[model samples]
Target: MSDQSVTDSRLDELAETFEFFDDWEDRYRYIIDLGKELTPLDDAEKVPEYKVEGCVSQVWLLVAEDAERPGALQFRGDSDAHIVKGLVAVLLTLFNGRTPQEILEFDARGALDRLDLAGHLSPSRSNGLFSMVRRIRALAAARGGQSEPTLH
Candidate 1:
């Protein structure tokens, strides 16, 4: 299967698995396994300039743009934490190479709920995930000319 197919399928599988598992332990293990399935990110992509701020773990995200196609962004990310790495993997697959409108239209919060991930994570980890999502959205908005007014 293509990366995109696996990405969408993984989301569906997560929803089904979460529904079947009654215990958080099982769910956590399942999530870890999911992380294991992530494709290896290139080492060169994980530079300091790509590092995502506010994550407790060492997380990095890199974005590339295609100017002719406004709002096109490609992402690559990595993390030291296995689970966090998996989470970033999932996000990269979904958001990468997407147009700004597409990224903005995605229901990331709803996807989290469907995957049943939010309730399992600690407050800080959840915050980190939100921060990552917001960063991607901001990048898309800035490139697409849909950015909201800023106080600066």
Candidate 2:
């Protein structure tokens, strides 16, 4: 299967999982659980350079393109807050291992709506989420091309 399909499938699965919870509280628990599942970034990777701006919590994102395949990206992210870390996991599930075109084309707002997160998140968290997406797209634009640019 293509990388885009795999990412889409994961998103779909998440949507399906959200359907199981009737209340936001249950969903929040699920989100926290997902955060626990994320691979922790190295302490060195959490420096200022990797820090995501505009976040209420201390969040960092590190993106790297696949060595063997061009345009295929991987993401490592973390947050000081549990809920924000979970949010990072959600974004990672949607964008990681996909091409730049795929990341740019995917309807992130629609996905958030499907998960019913749009109304649940605070303004700052929502902005932080978009910031994460923007950072990913910026990385994609740089690495998706023929030239391999250094990821910040």
**Per-model TM against the reference:** 0.72, 0.87
**Model 1 lDDT per residue over 1-152, tens place:** 65445446756866776789889888777666766776556788777777778788878776678554455788766788987877786677567767776677777787787776677798888878877788777777877789733211
Which regions of candidate 2 deviate over 4 angstroms? 1-3, 67-70, 146-152
User: What TM-score does model 1 achieve against the real structure?
Assistant: 0.72
Query: Per-prediction count of colliding residue pairs?
Result: 0, 0
Model 2 misses residue 80 by how many Å?
Answer: 0.3
lDDT of 2 by residue, 39-93 (tens): 8898999999989888889999888876766767888899999999999999898
Worst 10 residues of 2 by lDDT: 143-152
Q: How many backbone clashes does candidate 1 have?
A: 0
